[model samples]
Target chain A: MTLNDTDVRAVLHRATDHLSSPDGLVEGVRRGGRRRVARRRLLAGGLAVVTAASVAGVLQFSGTGDERIDVASPLFDEPTRGDLARDPAFLREVTDAWRGATENAELWLRGEPHVVWAGNTPKGKAAYVAQRSLDNPVVVQPEGERLIGYAGFVVPTANGLRVLTFEQFHDSGNLDGNSQAVLLGPDRDTLLVLDFGHPVEYSPSMSYAPDGRIVRQRLPVTFRDGAASLPVPPQLTKVTIAVGRAPMSVDSRIHVVNENEILFPDGKERPEPRRFDYVLPGADRAWGAAVAPTAWPPGAVAALAPFLDSIGTHVVDPEAPDLTVFGATPDGRRLLVSTIQYDDDPGHAVAMLGRGESEYPVVATQPVDWAEPLPVRLRLPDEQGTLVAAPEAKLEYRTGASGTWLDAGRGAALLPAGATDVRVTPASGVARTVRL
Target chain B: MRDVRGTEFDDFVRTRSVSLLRVAYLLTGDRHAAEDLLQEVLEQVYVRWRRVRTTPEAYARRALVNRAANRWRRRARRPESALGDLDPATPDATDDVALREAVVGALRAVPPRQRAAVVLRYLEDLSVAETAAALDCSEGAVKSHTARGLAKLREALAGSGLVVTIPNGSGSSR
Candidate 1:
């Protein structure tokens, strides 16, 4: 039977109808509400004191170190520019500003702030300051000194250089993975991005027109010495910065910026409806790790017990393997599959077919060499067709060797009915055939 | 001291808690988490009682959606629990129970914002404009999120032998 809006609503209501508020709900609300009010009042008073101290230039650096001396670090090794990097007076002003900003912030500076890069852009003069933070409340365990600070641009005003924007950065320790973008400039139209290691390709944003068509636009990024600057449209609120040349590569890191400000335009510009059919839910291995257990079909655990035992306790990870049930055949036989990766061992894909009431036989098991471009193909038992697993690529499959290629969806797909052999093509690789 | 505002807030909670709890349960997919989420949203509503007393439900709903989104993001960052060797016994004898379980499980795969859009638009029977207000996005965004959410739900449900078809112009206002 086909399910529609009414059926979906009915299903949701049925799922939640039995749930009710627990006892003391109201009392709990009142108590928490009162506490929040008290905290807000206390925070307001503290902020007032901080503001006064900042204005008076009496903000004390609490962490251990000489705040006046700029410490040498690998993160701040880049040469400074913009004619102000060598000016001692200007550098001191920027350091004071950094101290004031972090005084009330969660991350406190451990060492003296040093200028990493400074330059004059179309907007104004900006400098990238790098500092060491011993205490980062965000991370659970504070390692040694971590590089954390902000990059700000100052626009010329009647009264000296006014700071237009200050974009904060915290070192995740992964240089190739660090990325951040912010809208700066007086008009809030210049997109400034600080991407370490790899140069940013472009920043793309998606919106929908009134006619329900998806509109995608990419802002080209120009990088000079690690900082990227580009002009962005005023209407766009969110952008995903793609780092590295290969956008779909596993090594590429995509950082989504301004998530809360995401907006869609009205019917001003009509763009063709982008085919979202290739997108699949929970395609990422991380998502599979989280949701796979709850998503397992009935009797699947008992069915795969033998296979699990054969793999031995040492090879089996304490964490669950990423499992996906492609679907069941017309006669109740289900295809169960999982991608298993063990530390210091080669990754492999395991497939099992569940039949009758209590029999699950292993069908196809193949090693997954991630360095290769070929998709992992597992042929089902009894000429049922192949189960294709390619998480990072778009897939297409043809029923017969010479048949037309059809969209195989995103992560996985089962062969069409009565198909003997199938050819699979990945988004980045050449086509290969999996025969039954 | 309990004042008139406190009394009114209490009354609102007493009357609307059941429906609000249901919304939380659907959004969270777990009963205990749902209770915690609803109580948290209600606490925020109580704190802003004077300002949102006239339209408390709308304010509470918007807060619930935003909080759920935040909770999902936090959960994504943490390490996930390992799957047990034994599956929990579920009574799938009845089609209704099976369908309910399928819908809830599928909802877990959807992104938090898209899930909120789907819940508000379908389960709550809200208009596009209402869903937009709750999600703090434009009407067109509401449509896009809902459509994408429905598409994902349909694909997830496909394996369960339950085909979910989106109606033509599903995200049109009301």
Candidate 2:
């Protein structure tokens, strides 16, 4: 049976008619709103102080060019940690090693590096250092001392303490704080994630099968002095760091790191590139490069004005170059497509099809990376069949789950009338069957 | 003394929240995300209650659409695979479950702007001009987005073997 616009509206109503505003929604909004206002006020007050300081020239460099101003870091006030906390000689040696490692470093060190935590790991002796540096002047602010540090595992060899790996830590002012995880241990099986602000939980890296099934392994993270570490399970390719406790909210900060990239001590080798069934058409472009904007189609501009206007709301600079491409479905419907690439973040694309003179309806929008792009599916308005856009993949379709696969056109094809699924086999990878 | 503005805000929430939540549900395609998005928008509305009380529903809607768009952009930045773990949709069965799921899934695939236009125009039954006002774009743009959005919905439904008829005399007006 065919559905109509009225039927579609009925379906939407039926789908959402059961949803009611939860109790305490108003109270929650009020509470959150008050906090938001308070935060805004506090930020405004802080901005005033910074402005006043700038007006008074308090932020300007005050000393002569050759004079060195050494201010002790606040971290020095905090007591040290670990088994060698009271061992002055051991502390001195770690401090010396830090100084030597950073001696010729390009960072502007305003004060000496101090070892704040020295502990024994399964791998070897490890030390965490905190130093005063002017690497980020904005963060340094009125006090003029910004904390930049490094943590590493040290092993004693024939000569002396060999610094296995020293991972530098600095905040990019990301309000969420800075975190770095390194793989250590003799077999590189220990994962140490050092967070400067808050403790975080982690899950072993996940791998996605060709069929989009995810295999994830969870490991408990043990936290000690703002550092979380876990034993990396064998064949773990990556790790995902998440903040907060159980039942984490959707907005919780989560980061995925390829384990091979952080192989502590000797992190010089790069891992092999991951293979996917379908890669982006032009994945090699240097991010943030100037992309020539699609010359707006005069015929399609009126229909796309809202999309174009909405771009500014999503991107940092609406004036920056954006790339938009135009294509067509199997039914010869014109489609205007644009990839929403902003900054270094991965993005999705917008595709609107021209239908009946000036009506341009959106047909398909999907992510540009990570997810499988094979069996490129685009449904044409009014049952014109699904348009598959795999120029190099062999295509087959079936009318039912157990139906026989029938050969479909190459490059692109409209699914056969009443087809339920399509099998897409790329030039090299395994064939994937996508439900229509 | 009674806080008149607070009472008015409470009344607005009590009266209009159900409809607004439905819009949010269609926009985000996840119940939890929809609730979160609605509450966040309501908070913004409450903060600006004095200025927006005049047209609180419209303001709330505009805020919802924009917030949903921003949320989509943020979600897009994460690895696409990670998205499945965030607020998975709860299953709800109904007589029209297959058709509803197909329609909703298809709508979720549309771009944020186009989806907003469709939800506002088709689902909420807003006129082209009203949708344009809420989207803060030109009427012509509204026509284009709604048309394109509807076209996508139609195509997606058709591919799922559910043919949907376009509204009578419904085409983009030049």
Candidate 3:
């Protein structure tokens, strides 16, 4: 029948009830547990499977020439005089200001699992410049009334101050606090963020607006979780300190919904540990010994390298390296993607992600789902570019036609500074019609 | 690792269970798929509770949508489960149960995305902007998806020769 608003609601109610049902909740956890454990083992072991191409031995990056030129971000390519890229002087000034604000912005360092944004001076040069981990990000303008979602990167400038790597639709979408990010007022001290009120208090993802403001802040809270709180200074009552070579910290305030505090250590924030790990049995046959410590650009690999190998004990990868399902899938060989600020980009020279591993230059593709849209420079001829989407879902893809250009997949996943390589892949099996 | 997410998440399941179950059912098309979908979402939520902002329902919903989309991505992925009595807890299901079943039956007649659009737009009552945001597409996409979804829903029902009169107001709307 023509499902009316009520019918629609009824259907949703049914679906949501099913999702939130006791049985459903139990099962979701079971899967997560299984997946997480498997993944952690793979990541730690450091070996994943790789195999020779059936016909062609090599999978070209983005299926394009290795010497591809970096195209201006499609979102900001049309820079008008007043646009961020338009006025040289204004841009320089902002850039310089960003530099000054982030100077001494040591706290902006992006640690894995938990990224912390803190600064010594609120109005100083380093105040807003400390967070370079959350790279180019965009808020989805808050999803369901109850859920607001945002993603970005915090990268440091040459001068050392961290700045929001505002990328993609974020320039247009109102992300509030994070969009119009700048150390404000006198001496450029205040790190201002525009934030919209989310229904829940903590455990939610935070989004920023173009002008460096936090527009939507959904804690995705549950009354049962605990006393609601925000991700602010004092509100950071507790910090999950993963102590190791460096400390990884998270705001305990995020646990506002969970009344009873979960057990995490207190001290210098140590790096967050991998949730799970495993080794692929046929790792040797796939990845040659020369491809030691096989590291692709960010956004590559479906899960832990080893984990994928185990699925079949023989199938190296199903998707392919640097696969941005949304990007150029012409032959589905290569993919291109971006990285986050602090976590991946090592340019800041402030090491994060334990072992100082740069997580950046986001690649494309994932085991679960391929990300939307590929970079402009990386599409194929006929498949050049288009947005592939499911009817009413935010799930979509934009990519090039050819296999030679860069393709960004979903898990290139809004990253932080220290994020690297501009391009990477998830599943190494999926191939593209690589060029050059 | 023993899941530390029990206490709080459990409470969420106890209360919002009705709503969660409903959404799960919508995404998967059957009780079994719905349950499986819900379970998968819950596990993911549990693992990343802190990052997920402690809202089990929110996490569960995101996962459910994602999982449903993943399942749907593979045309081979079809629901193998069946829905029980409409009320779930009670056997009082009647004409409404049949109507609900009919809605789902009609729903399958449409494309997956369109079906989701109808559910999110009309059923979930998601605003145009919110629907687009949740669906992760442009607002234009949401509008188009909704329009197409509604048309397909209508056609599906017509094929079944079932007519559902929509009342303008009153408790019937609920």
Candidate 4:
């Protein structure tokens, strides 16, 4: 028999003529598209876990089999003026390095290099000065005496010069008196200290002092580059960060506060705080990048190494979570840290000090900035009959055994004697149970 | 002016869906499976509709052929159902109906890859290279599959009073 293309084409066409396009083809495609996306996401999540485990395993095994490895402190030993003057070799090295760096045209084209900080020796003479070269933008410490102590990174921004630094003035007997970290911003003529007169500890309450007068005191959450830098929200002004244990199973959440006002614990009306909660991957080997800041001073990484070493190993675990919140005072001067576990125990705060006392009291409770939001905020009455008002904010009040929630918009639906078993939920933010 | 991407896609589906469904039906050999294949292809096209709109038909047809090929690969382990059972309608007591049924039965017996090559090469009238691209293979494989598929059809339709001839060299068979 002779077989040709026409015979085959015509016959096949006639055979399949009864079949038609599916009625819900577009809808089916939409559903299939969703499933495909879910599959891709699951695959990507799996790959991230595998990569984290491989990295953790490599870090764990690459170390020497010793049960404990002491990571040497990166801070200078016995930072004093006498040590600076006596070290001719180090002094010569510092001078030559600065001279060579300045000679390069690439290091001074953008701006002139200036001495950001100068250390004082025992005899009240300048021991050494740390100058930042803007052309290349690096911290350079030039020679002088060795005994002096100075640690910080001076950053020049569009606003002005900001310094991340810690210094102890040796003039008086008050060791803690002069030991302060400051972040100086462009807003005011005076310096701003983030944790001034405060012990170097995990996630200290932030204080902003302009012209030596305290302007603001509040908690801030800071996240750094673990996989990638967690960028500062464009609208946020002050950021303070501390690492804490996971409040729940998921690693993070962003809580948007209501735009309206709410009564603070002090009975003064203030807008509720909006913040992001990031729970580091728990004890499980599954992981993401350990969070950290993208930009740090030349020596800041070295200074921070001891803090991380004191807490845990290179690998991060989800169940046994290890995290650190890196923040500065409003002025961006002092370094602040907060963590769940440090030095193999909870409630331990350590400031990296060259000499003198370093231990400080653990905060009685996790700072409000780092804690999860409560269900509600119901302030008791003041001396006058004015109930604390949250301007233009709606509140949901739940009363009695009926398990029903009733709207009490700006105190409109409440009884004069107050309702029993009332729970108040803000128009936004977490809710709280209120006693009438 | 509003965006025209959604309207353009709807127009293309309205105009070309029947032709696409026919190709899908021939490739899948089942009505339900043909609809599934067509929908799957449309979904993929919908995702990149902006980029594929200019050559939407070609893009969709390629996807349909490839997806059908994949389904066949997965279903390769299953035994082939009897061709007569595919459509139980007794031929409408006509000579042309019997011959058409005989051709369909013969085409069903061909393996999926060979069937795709045959439908693409003979029915849809794609070149050896186009068929190779649609099947994601070399031109040589397309040529070999087409030849073997036609030979199978010639044998299956020998006694059914239908003559099937595959032209040699570089000329159109018609």
Candidate 5:
């Protein structure tokens, strides 16, 4: 027999009691650890040798000129104090335009250099460029330390200055093999980045259509880069992503395409249906780069309406069913993670990608600032140390064992003086003046 | 070194399982069906926990409702006559217990989404907007489901010999 009012209230009380209890979650985590480890190993095993960033001291970056930029100050703000520090003013429309462009005049003039993050062999599926723009703007800060636009890219807006960054990482994890691990989000403290504002975990879901072709989702992430970094593209809004490729080495074919009515979870924009074929070859255990459309474009699968019926809707299954993980679930299923989800086991380097303490998803991959010539400077604390900057040929770092130099797309980061353990290596081996 | 995967996952399960189970019960109705529904949902949820943990409740809730509806749709293709045995086309006697059972059984007859709307609205005491959020349907769709579910419930309960009665004309508004 169902209980009366008092009993019903008791059950409700039992359910909600944990919300206020302190150790409830802590105890649950203690229970989930074993399976997570195995999943991590499994995911790691599938990964091709991810090339390490090169050790380079002096490298030059070429970029398009900042012709449209109204204010010309190489010295930008260096924000050190984290979120507690002042936020960098958003880049002007003119500055936002140059974020994506390489081979710019100022970049070449200032000797911009970056280490290629794609891969060593370079013949992989695609390249995801994670960059850091090291510049100095002269804007002053009130409660500011300096400004570091981590998750935020350069965007030109109405007022000419705006910076859109996650004040925090909302859903944080140090998954086994995904970019969102360190792709820290903004305003994570209160905002749940689940809906629209989260970063893309650089893992794609893949499944084979009955027609013996692989269907995949293309993901493009704008990392810390030049003045030309693009904001989240139009395609990724609302849609979840899965990536897969053809098993054989044969080139990818557009077997079936369909564009159907697209609706956002919040009903913001109306996107038409689209379906088409694109090239999707398996990654050849190397670094690669390719441009992909953000969302399944409307009108893509015009002719394949019948086949489209069996194919699942273009909904991104929110859960990462196949994580390709190394651990197992509590129920004894092998932990498999895919896409951006990874095992955030503590003390592991990968786990380092997760947000601190909060266990959120954002990890800071790049920390950069420039000299006084640039307005933005990563202010030096009272600690004693000797620092260094790029193009100072004295320091040399290489990508893996290969001889590749590192350089920024815009201006290179600056080196501070004193005894700090800052090191910069490059692909090129040469003697150059140390900018002290 | 101590396999943290399953244990950590179990921790997540322990924390979120009840909330999920409550939602499952609301969707499926009854303790037994809710248990089965929750087990299936949790298994599916477990697979994606690594990623979904970013927004676990959001992902799990959507999956739960979709899976439940998909299950019903598959059953729908079977002979419509199968339900005739359970469904009382005619009115019957109404005890409070009998009334609740009749309402619940009728809920099963409705589509999963619509049934979810009724349970969330009435049994669970959620608002129109809250039901929509949980069901992940348009607010208009929630209203239609609520209306249709209430009507079907009225017919089923009324057919149970009129022995047990629902307070007020439930079909009129809320």
Candidate 6:
């Protein structure tokens, strides 16, 4: 039995005998042609931007910085050319003109509008660049459709700006205009990014694009969560601002006590508070003793001990130290930790459970002003309990034999055995003891 | 400026899509992938309609070959998730269905370029010089690839007790 050309043809026909052109082949071709035309238009727009920039001579920078002030950007390898000392006015004029043009470039690529806004730090420069479609907030490019993706930076000299951060929706894959900060770097050409609020770094973690360009402009820069929206000075074409910090968290176990009560005991109801020690990763273990205040529950102290110890080492630096603290639930499930350091401007000194990491919030409240006091609520898995408090009041729980006042996390614990009442005091309002 | 209207392209598609789809299915073993490949090449033809219209079938075949090569390269770079579905040890020569399956599976086993060489030579009935021109390779390279491809197909299907015989003096014409 030999397989000849005729046999091969028979098998080939058998495999594809039922195949035919799709109903929309012509329409598909027309759509593809439109996309090709759009790509050509984008290429032309990019060339136009490059050409117009060269003619303006606005990008002139020494690509050199002060010997003491080291400057870096994730997208570019070398410093952009600049003559900062020679002509401040010329630099200023060119920076302003370029920024104005960039703000108005409004180049629509593949049906999406792209905009860039150059900013400045007192000592460096930065920019906030984004591509968005108001009609379609989702950035996921449809199959066979090319969506605009960028790999570039806002380069600024150290004498100009130092921090570069961008708002990126890491897990969502779409660049939604959320307060979530995706990429963060300080004086480094490439940024190490944390994806999806995880403590561990993401793969391909650095943003380093070779052909990154420097733009000078003052567009709308919105800084929330204590991030500074700085001005773009004349000396800098690019700018950098501090990246957003991820929230901190810890794991806790609790037993439900009827409708409004849950007890946090070593295992079950305890006459004493549960004790668990933890050393914050990336911080000095010894300093944990110095940092854990009596106002915090022993578990909160144990959770924050390492970070407090490491503060002495990071104190000299003006910026907040990036930290990750790990803890485990009573059942031993790994609890994710994200931290905002003491020096973080606009960030609080308190350590608290981040949203969506665990079932309960474990917070160690410092007397910092920025700690937004979350409302207190206690409930079992099924039923809601009746406990009332003033709107301005923060929740307080009883701790130790002396019943010392402790800041409470926004969660309920397991109800204690034979406990008739669970007392919750507000910061200023009267104490509310719910009868179980 | 090549302004070929939708009806002209549609007419051409309605007439030749089945033949083009068959060639694509032989090139890519999967039916859906073959349809996709044909649609993609047709879209390319639409963009360069004026130049492509002169030798539409040949241009479409060339585009299909290039696209398959690129897709194969990308797939090769991806990590292997499982042991391949084609088992080398289980080729049964007695079963006709198994032989057909072995033959079809063996086509995918050869390297993409060599497979294209084999398909153009035997399936499309193209001569050596024409296959060489289609593959953008020398005639000697085409002959070498065809011989190696046939030998590989024969070896792959040998476990099933299937024998592949090359036609004598075939694919020799200019």
DockQ of each: 0.23, 0.19, 0.20, 0.18, 0.03, 0.19
The positional error of residue B24 in candidate 2, measured at the CA in angstroms, is 0.9
User: Per-residue CA lDDT of candidate 2, range A1-436, in tens?
Assistant: 3346676666677767768889899878866674444333323222111110110112223354223333223243357766667778878888887666545232235455666666656655656665654333222232333224333334433466554433333332222222244455544566655544444555544343332223344444566764555665542332232333222333433322223333221343333322212222221131112222234445455554433322111122232223344344455565555444332234444556664345665556554452463424655566655655554668889998999999975545656448898888877888888887
Using lDDT as the measure, name the better of candidate 4 and candidate 6.
6
**What is the lDDT for A230 in model 6?**
31
TM-score to true structure, per model:
0.36, 0.37, 0.33, 0.35, 0.29, 0.37
Chain A vs. native, model 1, TM-score = 0.37
**Mind giving the per-residue lDDT tens digits that candidate 5 earns over A1-436?**
1223233223333322222222343333332332222232222222111111112221332332221111111112222211212222311222333333322111211222211111111111111121232321211221211111112212223443222211111111111112111111221111101111223322133444433233544444333321111222122222222211222111211111111112233323333312211211221111023112242112222212222212122443322121111221122211111122111101101101111122222111112222212211222223211122232223422333333444321212322223122224333543332222
lDDT against true structure, model 5: 0.33
Error of 4 at A151 (Å): 41
lDDT of 1 by residue, B1-174 (tens): 124364789989999898888777667766677788898899888767878999999899999998888887887797743221112325444665566567767888888889999889887888999999999999999999998887787667766775455543432357
Q: How good is the docking of model 3, as DockQ?
A: 0.20
Off by over 4 Å in 2: A1-3, A46-436, B1-4, B81-94, B162-174
- Model 3 gets an lDDT of 0.35
What is the C-alpha lDDT profile of model 6 across B88-151, one tens digit per residue? 2233333544544565578778898888888887767778987887888899999898888876
TM-score of chain A of 2: 0.45
On the 0 to 100 scale, the lDDT of residue B167 in model 4 is: 50
lDDT of each: 0.55, 0.56, 0.35, 0.40, 0.33, 0.41
Cα lDDT tens digits for candidate 3, A127-220: 1111122222212232211111112223334544444432112222232222222223222222233112233232122232331222232223
How close is chain B to the truth by TM-score, in each candidate? 0.83, 0.85, 0.74, 0.77, 0.63, 0.77
What are the runs in model 3 whose C-alpha is more than 4 Å off?
A1-4, A7-436, B1-6, B54-56, B75-94, B158-163, B166-174
Error of 2 at A112 (Å): 48
How much lDDT does candidate 4 score? Answer: 0.40
What's the ranking of the predictions by lDDT, best on top?
Answer: 2, 1, 6, 4, 3, 5
Where in model 1 is the C-alpha error above 4 Å? Answer: A47-436, B1-4, B81-97, B162-172
Q: Candidate 2 chain A: minimum summed lDDT over ten consecutive residues — where?
A: A48-57
Off by over 4 Å in 6: A1-11, A43-436, B1-3, B79-100, B158-171
